[model samples]
Target: MKKTIIFIMLVAMNFFISCGNSTNSEITTQKENEIVSNNEENSDKENDEGKEEQIIKIEDNEEDEVVISKSQAYLDRYFQLEKELEDSLAGKYSGTTIDMKEAVSIEYDSWDELLNEIYGVLQEQLSEEEMKAVREEQIQWLTIRDSKAGESANEVEGGTMEPLVYESSLAQSTKERCYELINNYMK
Candidate 1:
């Protein structure tokens, strides 16, 4: 009877040990499945948001207009050039006026290209009346930009930093104008 009692206790312990392991494995599997499901849901949400952001809809009495987002390539190039200019000024030139002027000049070229691209888009997308209005605004903006740039340079007249400041001002104004045109007219 003693031996039988010991054997029964061992069998009970073995059953309990096996059940504990099975429960732990099931819990682990459940946690992994939950993580995978959460990841899939987050991915779906991101895709939906991306799609919504890429399209701009404008309601007009004349027609319904859809303005697609500009090509990322052009913007990417502009940003990349700006970054390169910053890096050069900070590291290689150490903020020297001459080197800064050269760097700003390169950035100005990029801004000029962006301006041309915005102009091309306007020409293709705008009605003749709208185009004429934009052209007039652009001419006025150019005058202001040139005058401001000259005044900014004059602030440091005869100084080594004058050209650098002038080019920087021009680049900044052009960039702002590009954004303004895109926001006001493109949409």
Candidate 2:
């Protein structure tokens, strides 16, 4: 009778230990599965938001394209004329009459203000046709002048003027374009 009780007690203890291990394993597996599912849900949410943002970008870019293209064309035309005007002025007056240093100072609070003032002062003073004609003449003159300069450079010792001198000569043209664009836009 003593051996029988000891055997039964040992058997019950072994069975309970085995069941406890299985239960702990099942709980751990359940926790791991839950964590994995949560991660998957978060990743999917992020992907959806990214796709929406890309769609918005595409839409905005489409609208911007037309405006950007038009502005680019207008600015190109304005800059070309501005360059010609500067080159003409420099050829006639060198560094004497209108100093580049003096023209760069801006008293206006902003570009918009400057433009408004310019337009207010000059819109009625010149006609659009006159502006167009002047721009055409300047472009023509610049083409001729640039061709001559190129020819002269070809005849020189190194086939090109020194970079510094070339840059100085062109600086006025660049400034003229900047001013012209501002003034024209104001108009």
Candidate 3:
């Protein structure tokens, strides 16, 4: 009778444990589904926002032609570009860790390209002295950008996450710099 009772107790304990695991698994699945649903809703909103942001480019016909167009337009376009890159990253975000790091680096590249383009435009618009100051400031900014990226990366040095953190910092910093240039210098 004692053996029988012990066997029955073991069975009951096993049943409870299996039930608990199933419940936990179900809860995790439910949370994942909700996240996917929310992301879809956010994507729909971003697409709608994209339709409304119209980017009109200001052409420079002469070496010193002033860009009378609203700087807001360029800013809007830059925002659009950022959204597109984010969408692209989201599409590939489910991949392995290395892929995520690469996605961030690619996004950084886009920001860097835009920065160079804006710098070129400023070169045409600003006089020699103004550009000299901007040039010095830009050099300083580059140093800061690199130092900041390194500092962030050092937090996770030699770990699998180092590249992702480093690249993300660079991308964020570059994006901020792009906006600063457009807001401060573009007329």
Candidate 4:
């Protein structure tokens, strides 16, 4: 049952975590670069590699290049490291239901923290009007997040796996929301 739950999570999460071409026509790329290191300018502080991955996006005009600060490379590297951490933690803490719970709980906590950071950054970075729009969207998102988490947990209601599923669901959805907030709202 636990394996089934984890498998479902991995499958569901793959959809959002995988990076593909942007829907916006304005975004283009001359070439995709290997995981380049982020500079002092626009990288996650948690990046230990001292290197940031690069995600190129050219404007439709071709002449005007658009480098979205604190996005792209940051997200790429952050997501990579995040995946590694989750896998590592899951392995480290697995065996018993208690251990699985710890791993997923940690994962959920990490994602929750990232959401807070992203939300704070957006609050500062977005304009008054844009912020208002996102603020409303965020309110709606919070409701959805709770409902989704509960629904996922209910799949195994009264079982030992219930809380584990709940936390993993929260972690997965919150992680997706982090990416959504960045890609859609972040400039």
lDDT values for all models: 0.79, 0.54, 0.86, 0.76
RMSD of each: 7.4, 14.7, 21.5, 29.1
Give every collision pair in model 1. Answer: none
Tell me the deviation in Å of residue 89 in model 2. 36
- By lDDT, the better pick of 2 and 3 is 3
TM-score of each: 0.58, 0.31, 0.62, 0.61
Write candidate 1's Cα lDDT for 1-187 as tens digits.
9999999999999999999999999999999999999999999999888766654333332243235545344455556756776766565346666667777887788788888987898898889999999999999999999999999999999998888889889999988887777767874
Clashing residue pairs for model 4: 36-52, 37-51, 37-52, 38-51, 38-52
lDDT of 2 by residue, 25-76 (tens): 9999999999999999999999999999998897879757654554565456
- Candidate 1 regions exceeding 4 Å error are 1-66, 71-89
Clashing pairs in 3: none
| lDDT tens digits by residue: candidate 4, 59-87 | 34333333365667558755885977767
Ten contiguous residues minimizing lDDT sum, candidate 2: 101-110
lDDT tens readout by residue for model 3, 87-111? 8889666798978878988988999
For model 4, the local distance difference test gives: 0.76
| Model 3: residue 170 alpha-carbon error in angstroms | 1.2
Pairs clashing in candidate 2? none
**Candidate 4 global Cα RMSD:** 29.1
